[model samples]
Every structure is written in C-alpha cells, then in structure tokens.
Target: MKRTFTEGLGRKELAEIKACTQCRECLRYCPVQEVTGRVEISPSEKIRIYRDFIERTESLRALITGRDIPEQLLKDFTRAVFECTTCGVCGEVCPAGIDTQRLWPLLRREMVKRGLGPVGGQAEMPEVIRNTGNPYNQPPSERYRPWFPDETEIAEKAEVAYYVGCTGAYQAQPMVRGDVLILKAIGIEFTMLKEEEEVCCGFPLFITGQHELLEGLVKRLVDAYKNKGVKELVCSCPCCVNMMAKDWPFYYGKELPFKIVHVTQYALKAIKTGKLRIDHGLEERLIYHDPCYLSRGVGVIKEPRDVLRSIPGVELIEFDRWGRLSRCCGAGGAARKVFHDNAVAIARLSIDEACHRGADRLVLSCPACYEKVNDAMKDYPKKVRIVDIMELLSEIIYGQNA
Candidate 1:
C-alpha cells in the first residue's frame, strides 16, 4: 500500500502543529502576513488548518472510508503555504520553539504529494530543471560563457571548487564574476564544472516541495565534484550552500566527500591571514543586509559583517533589525515566482528602511535578494544602490567595473 499524506509527516512535525499556541506572535513577524495583510496566511493559522486536516484524516470515519478534508479548505491552505516566503523569521520569534523553516517545507512536500501545491510559475520548476538543468529554462551553454571572469582560471582538478548556483549564473552574473575575481586575487586554486555539468543546486526544487529529481541532482553533483578531486566546495549563494551543508548528506546517504563553505566564510580567513588585501578605500556609509539562509539558517551572521568592516575608509551601519532578526528579502521559498507583487513590496521594505537610515549602498550577499531588491529599486523615488558584497569588494580592489 502507498504511504498516506499524514504518514509522510513525521512525529516531530505533527507535534509542532499541535504545539502552536495561537498566541499570534508569529503573525507580526511573518513577511507574507505583513505584506498581504491576509490573516489566513499567518503562520499560526496555517498550523491550525493543517492540524485540522490531520484530525480529519485520522478520524474513525476517515479510516473506514477515506479522509474527507474540504476542497475549499485545501485550496485556502495551499494559498497560505505557498504564499509564505519561508524566511524563518517567524520561527526565530516563535515562543513555542517550532522550526517553521524546516516544518514549512515538509508541509509543502505533503501538498506536492497530493498534487495541490506550488502555485503559478513555481509549478514549472521541476520540469524545467530536468529539461534544462535550471529553473529559468535558458540554454545551458549560456550559463558561464557570457559572464565568466576572463582572469580567473579553472583547474582540471583541485581541492577547492566554486559552485555558481543557477541564480548567480543567470540572473546575477556580476556577483559570481566578483566571486571568481576575488578567488583569483587571493590565489586560491579552484575548479568549476563544465557549464553543462554545473546544473541547478536543487534549491528551487527543494524549496517549492518538488523532490523527485533531488536525489538524482544531489548524486550527480556529488559524484562530479568527487571525481574532480574537490575537497572543499565554495559557493556564493546562501541557499545553495545551506542545502549542500544541511541536506545533501541525507540524499547522498552519507557524509559528503567535500566540505561546504560559504564564500564569505572562506574570504574572512584570507583577510585575517594576509592572503587577501583591500588596498583601495571607499568612503561611504553602507548597510549589510543579511541573507536568511546564510544568517539564521546556517549561523553565518558574523563573517560577512567582519569582512565589510575590514575595508579601509568604510563606515559600516546596521538596519534596525539585522543579523538573526534580519528582514526577509522576500525572494525565498520560491514565493517570488507566484507572489511577485508581494515579493517586490516586501523587498521595498528593506530598501525603504535602508534609505531611511541614510545608507549610500545596501550591500547584499544573496543573489535572490540582490535580484529582487534591484527590481524593487526601479519604482521607488527614495533610492539607494543595491550591490552584492563580492561586487563591491571587486570594484574596490581592481578599479571600476572590475
């Protein structure tokens, strides 16, 4: 017999659903709730409806016949779940200590199993990734050829390899270019998979609750890196790094052969050890916006800040809520594809805050944040330039447009 939807939800998750206090604490912290002003989409309400589903499924009547959750209820629940940015802020603020970031995806996984989830353009992710090795469905040949830094060299086999995730490869090319430029300047020998070999890191698929291709994607990436003698995998995107560091082992069936390190973590060591130097000075006030996966998800709150503080003639500032309490870029959890207006509005919250604080530039580390916030900047009259930290560092070190 096939496994039931409730069967896929482990004991811990079921316990979490029951654990929600309905105290309305998470509602204020939820980005989707804040943006949409929709009470139904609040974290607490999601827990309530899902718990109701579990109850109906396990009832004596349901056991004898079948679970009979209302179609309208399911539709409402799906909207609420998919609309969430899954930024983990609610989880951070939860008095009940529920890990909503992890829990939300499990809920989404069950929804996908039932064929009722992943609204709008998000539904196209799995097929696109399988067909073109990326969610954008762009030609694989265009991944690196258009934007790879000319000065950087890719070794045939090396201990360190850089994974340019789909977003950086396609949407935010300059950020990855800066990543390679800094790596080259630091004299860190690194290798890269051939354009076609470096497929999506499976973050989009995983976050959207599509997992059928995950094991295959994970295995393929691991084997490719292992065959290339990669011992440390370096990446710029926090989502990719988080997925590799946290989830890849489960799919690989063991610890991965290589270690996963975010580029900021890698760069910080170089700065302290005198391997990398910032000789140029920039006299400007800048605020570093923390990426959700990098900060809260992986406990990487300090490294990026430490790096920014090291630059000469630079004054570092903070948002009112930063670090673990940082606001979501609103591009997370694949919500931006379907909830674009909300995504842009949520992103504007970050920009509006930065400009209000008199920041000259809003330095970001995540490509998703970079892309969405850049889009948000277009319409806002009160403007601040958005830049990736890597891109800023490259400009300082190698001159303009470097």
Candidate 2:
C-alpha cells in the first residue's frame, strides 16, 4: 500500500527523523559500518543527510518551484544509502525508534524515481530478472533440475506449496534438496513450481527500488499459487519468506490468499509433534547464524535455534552478534552480486567471529548466508563447517547417502 516515497515520508517518518539524538547506538550494531569502518555509511549519517535534504528541498519548495538539486548530492545520497545492507539493526538499537530499515529502502526508491540509484553492481538487476525466472541469469532448465534426492516425490496439486526461492534453486541447490527432503519426511504433501513457471518473489527488486517491475512479478506469482488452491506457502529462504509475508501485502495493499511460513517454523513444529525425528544426530559444537531477513525482517529469531537444538547431540552456541544483533553475512539486498569485494569483506567479519568463538561448525538457515559465508570460508577449511540447517537435517535423516 505504501506506493510512493512521499507517502512513506509523511508524519511518522518525519517525527522519527526529527527525534534522533544521534547517540550512535545504531552504528554499534550496523554490519556495514563494522565492515567498512566508515562514518559516512552509518545509519545516523544517512539520517542526518536525509533530514538536511528534506529540510532544504521543502523550504525551497523544490517539488513545485522546479528547483534543481545538485548532482553531487544525489551521488552522495546514492552511495550512503546503497552501500548499506539495511539489516534493520538500526531500528533495533535506535533510542528514538526510528525505522531506518524501512526508511532506507523508501529513500532508495525515491532515488531511483529521481534517476539517482540502483548503484554499483545492482543497476543491471531489473533487466536480468525480466529475462530470467531467477536472479542468477541461469537458464530455466538448469534451475529446474533437482540437486537433492532424486527419488523425492512432489505432489501435483497440494494444499501446501513449497516456494523454493531463487537462492535455493540456483546458488544453494543442495539446500533446496534438503528442504524438500524435510517436507517429505514429515509426511507433508507439497508442490513446487517448475523452474520455467517460477517467477522470483522480488525481494532483490523491492529493496533496490525496482518497484515498477515488482508488482507485476509478484502478482503473477500470487495468482499462479492462488489458482492452484494452495493454502500454506512454505519457504526455505528467509528473503522470500519476508517479502511474501510482509512486502507483498504492504506494497500491494491486499492480503495474500495463502499464509507464509518459513521452513524452520514448519520443521520446528514437526520436531515438537514427533512427526520429524533425527535418528542419527551429529555431535558437534555449532552456532546458528541468524539471517537478517528472518530475524529482523520477519521476527523469526527463535525458531531456527530451536530447530538446531531439537537435534540430539548438537551442542549449539551463539555468535558474538547473534539474534537481533546478528551481523549480516554480506549477501542480502543484492550486496554480494552488486558490490562483490565489499560484500565479501563484510562476510569475512562473521567468518572471523565464528573462528574466534571456537565454533566447530556454523549452521545457517538462509541461502544467502550459506552461499556468502561458505564462499568466504573456502580457503579457511579448518575454521568452521558452514552447513545449511535443512542440509544438516537431511544428512541426519538420509545418512551419508544424502
């Protein structure tokens, strides 16, 4: 329903902006600032710039007077805004309750409208999504091939549909296999859209201010799932779950036909009800890395940890920045794809944290975290075992054959 930057910037946002004490609490929690060590990218800094711009533009009646803002202003605004991962840590720590998480994207959307943004590596994303069903720009057939169990049965028309996100299909194919295995093992009937028929859930597009193409992309997905009589929409990726559960309804101003449930939520219930059992649980000192989308985006902090703890003999520990304070793995918001080196630098911080904490393994639920962090740990083989939660479960259920 929030269609424009102006609508998002009205009274509530203004009050939050005006009330900022600039205690720098947000900086302490920001992963981008932590990685870059730049005051320019701090949430406080962005807030200050935005407020100054708003005051000047409004005072001069720039909207109606045909006044021109400086090009350098737009360039600086774009850099400060886009460089941030928008992990919602600012909202969590802000004393003034400023929703910088929402504000940043809205600001980015305004930048795009003014022809200022989708900076760095994100500029080509819209065209890529339009041409391909997913973001990796891989062919549809390549995405359709199953990477998990070859014998897993997927129902044709089930009340439950597994919305395997683009990350699951492409980047972390094994995680998709693991998620499907878990669903089947739990005696849940589910269906997945064929890759050719699959359209992205549009989190990448939405966060980067490509709203113009997002509505149609999401609506096509919603209508297809709705037509199939699916009542429960289950997702393995937190990014997709967050967008489908929050963004779709908020942006479209309509309730979804089916409910959105993260795969961990479903797996947690299965564990409690005795439907899901891990007979051969691995004994390892592991830590659960909370993906920003699930924890801060959709408030799914507990379920992932609970799922990990449910496995017998898994000694779970916490990262220095876990749960609400979790550091981004530097993959979300198209950061890894757009700003590759900087994104990896951000990811390295978490990898170093896991190493310092002496965790034998890092259990990640989000495909973004799994891919980004796993890639970061490629050379540091002795540091920690980075495995997706679903993949870990599949191993327990199916043994080495999995």
Candidate 3:
C-alpha cells in the first residue's frame, strides 16, 4: 500500500493544520523560530502552508497568479517537514496544543510520495536498511570489532549479548570500548554477535515511514538473538534500545525472547549492587544534557544521572530546563542534513544554556546529541568539553590508560 500525497493528509491531518489560528504563540517558543525569526518558517506556519497546498482551489489560484510554488520551495518544504527533532518542545509551549511532531510525519509521508522524503543523508538510508539490515551498509561481522578477540569468544557463550550499534561500532568507538570495559569490570557474561550476524536496529527506517520493511528486519534480529539463547539485549545506543525493546514488538506482533536494556541502566544496576567499582574523581562542574531519545523518548532519566552522581567529586548542575523538558541538541530526524543552519541554531541554544550554568563540561547519553553538541560548541567563546556518559564512566572506572 504505497501512500499517495493526498492520501497521507487525510481528515485528521487536515484538521490539525486547519485548527491553527496563527496565534504566533508557538512562534515565540520555537527554538528555530527564535533564531530565524521568520513567521512562515515556524512549525505552525509551515503546517498552514502545507494545508494551503493541500487545498486544490487555493493551490491552483496561487499557480495562476504567477505565485506558483517552485521546485526549491517544494524541496525546502520537504526538508522542513522532517527537520523537526520531534522533541515535543513546541507542543510543550504551544498555547493551542497543536502536535507539530505528529503533523510533521504525516506531512512527510506525502513528501515521500512526491520523491521528496528522507532528505539528505537519510535519502539512501532506507535502501541500506533493506539490504544490509543496518543503515551503514556494513557487514554484520563488523559489529564485533568493538570486542577483544578473547572477549568475542567469551561473548559467544554468554547468557546476554551486547548489540553495539553502528555509531558505537564506527563513529563513537570509545562508547563501544567503554561498554565492553564496564561489562568486563562488572564480570557480566555477555556475548557479541559476530560481524556477519549483526543487523541495524531499523530505527531510521521506522521513523522515516518505511514501515513495511520493518517486519523483515525485526524478524531477522529476533531470530538471531533467540538462537543465541541470550536472556538480555544490552546496547549503548538509546535509539537501538527503543527500537528493539518497544518498536520491534509493534511491528512483529510478538515480544522478543530477550529483554532490552541500555548500557547505562546496566551500569547503574552494577554500581548500586557493588558489581562495578569506580576510583576516579571529577573536580569540575558537569551538566547532563538529557538526550531526547533517552530521557523524553524512554524515560531513562534517573539512571544516567544516578551513575554521574555515584562518581566522587563531581557536581551535577541543572539547567533552567532539564530532564523531559530539556531542549534538543538538534541532530535528530535527519534535521542536520536538511536544515543545517537551523539545526546548529538549536544546538547553540542548548550550548548557551550550558555555558550560562557555568559548567565545565556537557555530559550526554545519546551519540547523536554528543556529535551535534560538540559541533555546535566549536564557534562558542567558552571551551567546554562534550563527553558521552560511557566515555566519562570509562575514564573513571578504567583510568586514563583504559
């Protein structure tokens, strides 16, 4: 059932778009709107434009008046449609209670019908997921690069298997290293899927509206895990954890044999039970940026902070906005690709808050947030360090050498 553009904007979507009275209240609260200051660029304004385009009579009249929409406008619309991080910040402050996040996806499905979807880096992501079982198009054998050869062998026979996502495997190498190190320090027996056996968790695909392809990927992943007789599925990527733990069952119509846990949660459990030990001290002030997926998406707020608090000599400072209400670093939903400037603006907003708090470092749990925030800080006046929770924990538990 390929969705058509008109089919995507059914009554529900149309009503949401139509319900917007152009109050401009959402405009004042929008992070992007604040930076850009373009009323037409605000989330509500964009939805109104989309609604007008859907209206046949208005679209034709605009075209006849030489105000016909241009290809770039369409492209811009397509980009803006999915550019939102879906952080719910807009809805949180929306006086009209309009759900822009939900509206954006429905709008995006129509854009996809027009061959305008999955913009920028996400353009080829669905195809990669369809073929490689992951978006990186890397062989499953690559998944084991994070583990020592000896540990790999041990993992094969272990009761729990740690799924190191693509970012953990390739981009954030330290995260993978830290996860293995912490697991080993805790003496937790876990196996790793050999490179050829690993698959992408299909979050990008699921979010991008390639919902039909999800079942096959989910089936393949669940089958592989079940065959290992693994009791737990631990991962460092919160997106992967959300996909495997929550989304997979929705697509596959069955609960996976293994339970899913983010590595942070596991680390917190180990620390509390005295299974893992930390001897390091942090004398500097630290502020935790709740990754949208980790805190708001899954509500795993306490564990990461708890782990931070367990460290000696570290002061955890709260921003005026924190926890589920925390602002986004602006890299999610392929926003960085489509609207790079807007994404950076959002990232800078978060960074400005961190600087205002007078913190020496910005601690994050999500790899996406870590990457975006680090990039955003490059132009800032202050020299604040951005660190992933795993990297910080590893430094504390394993020392500088580890």
Tens-digit per-residue lDDT, 1-402, candidate 1: 644657877788878888999998988888887788888889999998887777777767568767877788888888888889889998899999899988888888888888899789888889999999999999999999888977678999999999999999999988998899889888989999998999988888888889889999999999999999999999999999989999999988999999999999888999999999999889999999999999989989999999899999889999988998889988999988788999999999988899999999999999999999988878678789988998898899899968
RMSD of candidate 2 to the truth, in angstroms, is: 2.9
Q: 1 or 3, which is superior by TM-score?
A: 1
Candidate 3, position 57, lDDT: 33
The global Cα lDDT (0 to 1) of model 3 is: 0.74
| Every candidate's lDDT | 0.90, 0.82, 0.74
For 1-402, candidate 2 gives per-residue lDDT tens digits of: 323334446687778778888789888888787777888878888888777776656655656654455779768878889888877888888888888767777888888877888887677778888998777788877775757467777788889998888888888887888898899899988887777878888888888987878888888888788888899999989889988988888665699888999999999999999999877777888888899889988889999889888888889989877887788888877767667776788788888878888888888898888888878766655457788999889888988678
RMSD of each: 1.6, 2.9, 4.0
Candidate 2 similarity to native, TM-score? 0.94
What is candidate 1's local distance difference test score? 0.90
**Candidate 3 segments exceeding 4 Å error:** 1-25, 50-76, 94-103, 130-133, 137-153
lDDT of 1 at 139: 93
Q: Could you tell me which residue pairs clash in candidate 1?
A: none
Q: Model 3: what TM-score?
A: 0.84
lDDT winner, 1 or 3? 1
Clashes of each: 0, 2, 6
Worst 10 residues of 2 by lDDT: 1-10
